[model samples]
Target: MNKKVWLIYGMLALATSTWGSAFIAGKYAVLSFEPATVAFLRFFGAAILLFPIMWIMVKNHTKPTLKDYGLFAILGLTGIAIYNICFFLASKHAPVIKSSLFIASNPVLIVLLSGLFLKEKITKNNIIGMIIALTGVAFIITNGHLLTLFQLGFEPIDWILLGAVVSWALYSVVGKIVLKKYTSVESTTYAVAFGTLFLLPFALFETTWQDVQLATWDAWVAIAHMSVFVTVVSFIMYYQGIKEVGAAKASIFINVMPVSAVIMATVFLGESFTFAHGIGAVCVLTGVYVGTNTKKWTLFKRQNKLRVQTKDSA
Candidate 1:
């Protein structure tokens, strides 16, 4: 693959890995900080860090118009402030497996929404790839029993999860267009800044320095990891991916998240890798291959095979 494709792959992989491991990191951070507080600190840290970098990147660039700022404010509210609050609250009440499975359908929602809002094509290969990828995601998360679909129930909290995914789908599809007006750096920074602003009131209500003061080393490490890698770096990569690939194709990479999380848990948390992991990984990769515009290698091989067959016939 070309450098551009490789860069996209690398960025997507890193972002997903950081996000996958965030469950562990968040688990640690929340031991001290409230979920709301953790959420706030993440955006606040990202926004603060981005200011200097944003200046360096945009100093000689066109200034974002007031209208652009307005759109960014909405972006923050939807993607960062609102989406996270809903996710945390829903996670408290929703069944873990069901939530994972449903959230894994995030790409599917993005594919459909991109078609509607972004006018991106939903191709046959993309559809087939999404199905295969999601099937693998469900298989791994459910440990391949497959009967959990019949057993799952949708409580009211589940709707919140659905809302969270929809909010993010809008964020991804909308942000793709927004990037045309702003640098990836500028877009990410402004959105995060606004999101942090909106989150301040709620976070301040629950946030106390006592938890931070009392936090263990592990908790602090997790806080930094989430703030830097999960929120900041991951958001940068995500926006870049959306800009490089269309939203639907970019979203497909998220299927790797469950696999990443499980692998991280196994290595760091001393969990076991099972047959389901192996199978699910294969399926996930296969799905990604199909979903993406990565046909050059396959086409090359097919052409070579055809040439050899013709020579043999002669």
Candidate 2:
């Protein structure tokens, strides 16, 4: 509502849009590069871009212990390495909009997982949110006929994309451990470094000079967009968004990512938006709203206020 809030919201939109566009970019890049190469180059370039920032942030900080290094390695393996590889594969095989939608479900999955592993409360609203989201997921994967899931008509690629979502959610959930010791940026730097290291062997054996030479200028441009905007600049803005707005408010901004991805993919990649997609998208977005905005909604606040007054009187 205020100037600063407007600025932060704008930045959050920029960050989400950049990330969403990365899916479109990846679709272009993979035409010339192997999926592994795409994954490797992304974080390798991201590491190069982020190093100076990381250095500036951590230069005077205390050195990490061996245990810390171990945690960083694990985060790198799960979040950066595995997640990147799976994501690239998903992009290669699945529709961009579908992949983005699956990604949009991350918050819901994180909520479900948090309840199980982190001993976090799974509120009634959260359960309602998960059901709404999963129903949307079912609709999309089944092409608007939820029974299609029973028929096994969905593409293997769709399943692969969904698996990538799980991998990413696990990355977020588990990173809490490393986050305890380091700032998000610092943890990200170490994770990217280690992840790139893990990707190197596959990149070396799988990606050749011929592949690089065969890549088009447009493909390289796509990679640069992802490496610079999506990986580095977007993350910096996201962190700032978190600082400006609380994490809860900032977290809701991520719902924009899928919408942006769908728009970019439709415009650039010539993807079609169908009635089924519209219905499913609405469901998914509504589910996110219900889940993330539980405390922010007017009705929820009014109910809380009344409950407090009742308690006091009693």
Candidate 3:
């Protein structure tokens, strides 16, 4: 409505677009480095920058208790280490667009997990949307051969991408607990620090100092982009959008991610968009919209209208 609001919207869009591009950058990074190494490098770089930023942004920071350390470790493991490892591994095997689509479906899983674990309410729309979104994911993964999933089972890369999605959902669910105690920036910074530590041994096992030194500039650039833009800057901007617009309104910008990923993959990676992708994208996006906007749906509107009319008649 106003200039500031428009600017916030722009930042939100740009943040999501950068997230889409992270898949592309990850695809490039995994071409040269092992998945563990690539993940380690990206987060290690992000951790370096995030600590100082967190320090500056969050004043009156108290010392972390032992429980806080444990929580941070869990966040690091689920959201950072495991998720990124699976992501880079999947990037090595799957198309970036496909990977992005899988990640885009994360909200469905988050909603389900929240209902189960957080004692949150699950509406009929949530169930219907989950079914539709999963159907789309099946189509995308099977290349529209959904029927064969029973006979053929999932591809290994599909499992890996699913792992990433589940890990991210868990990260978000756990983050709800952590955020109640700490600011998002503070929690994220500590989590990234611990995640970097967790990744170190695996990175060392997979690659030596010589190997790290020999990594191509393209790989370095990709890791840098993922660390600086995708992880840190995008998170900040998205959080800002949430602060200004409310989470539900800000979340609508996330739909732009998979679409942007498709476009970026086409333009930068020269990847082809398939018929299955088109169909799957439609289903997933529509399902996500419905899943998130339960109160805004026609049935709910009609129900509200009837209630209002009944009240007026009385």
Candidate 4:
């Protein structure tokens, strides 16, 4: 494997780690604020951080066309605005660890959607990997009770988190196409700016001056972390990783997010580390290793064999 590819993977690993922790931040923020308010503040903070850089980039290039603007708007709404709202709402009711497991399913959804629209082929390995990852997620969320899905009461947050996953998958696949025409930074900046715009009215209705006035220092710190790390840095790294490794391969890294979140929760929030969590983590790691490494090993063996044959001929 290329050293640069490994570097990109490392960056993505860090990005996913930061994202996993954002759930904890989101949970805290939503305790005192409405979901829309939290979403608004997060994006508003991101816009503040990204706007100057975006302006500098814009100054160096020509303004985007109307079509480009439309793409930005769509990306903004789906990826930033809608995704954050659903996530915050879900985190309000569900444990962050549980939500992370569901969110990890985004990669599987992305692969399926890509295969549907991009004409990507789905192999047996892909199916096996997805099933294994999803089964682990099921265990985490359902606590090994498969039948609880039809139980008397259901947490609406689970459905909302699932919606967030779907929205993020759509955002990623659509952004892949848009990135063909724009640099990642430019695309992200416009999308975030537009998303903030789209979220403004809803935030206004949901948030009040009193809420802002009443926010604690911890709340502000959480918002800042979400804006800088989860929103800006993570998105930038994710796009870079996807560029280095194609989306199909790049997405599998999402499996790490849930495990990271669970660990963070256990350490910082005093959440219990159950036997089920360990089992699910092992399953997820096994699936990722089998799915990603098998092909890599096959290629390595083929290359070595070719080298040996060439040496013999010489």
* lDDT for residue 97 in candidate 2, whole number 0-100: 83
Compose the digit string of candidate 2's lDDT tens values, residues 1-314.
78989999999988988889989988888888888788888888999988899888666665889988887888788788888887888788888888888778778878778778888777877778878887887777776888768777668787677677787777787777677777888888888999999999999998888888888998898888888999999999999899888788888889889999999889988988778888889889888788756666648768899999999999
Ranking by TM-score: 3, 2, 4, 1
Better of 1 and 2 by lDDT: 2
lDDT of 3 by residue, 1-314 (tens): 99999999999999999999888998889878899889999999999999999989889886789998998999999999999999999889999878888778888888889999899888888888888888888888988888889999988898999999999999999999898889989999999999899999999898977887788899999999999999999999999999999999899999999999999999999998899988888889878887777878757769999999999999
Q: Per-residue CA lDDT of candidate 4, range 163-273, in tens?
A: 898889788878878878777788888888998898899888988899889988888888889998998879778877887787666666666678788888878777787
Model 4, runs deviating above 4 Å: 1-12, 55-62, 150-154, 236-254, 284-314
Local distance difference test, each candidate: 0.72, 0.84, 0.90, 0.78
RMSD, every candidate, angstroms: 4.9, 3.3, 2.8, 5.0
Worst 10 residues of 2 by lDDT: 292-301
Q: How well does each candidate superpose onto the true structure, as a TM-score? A: 0.74, 0.92, 0.94, 0.82
After superposition, the stretches of candidate 2 with alpha carbons farther than 4 Å from their true spots are: 297-314
Task: For model 3, give the 10-residue run with minimal summed lDDT.
Answer: 292-301
Q: Compare the candidates by TM-score and give the number of the best one.
A: 3
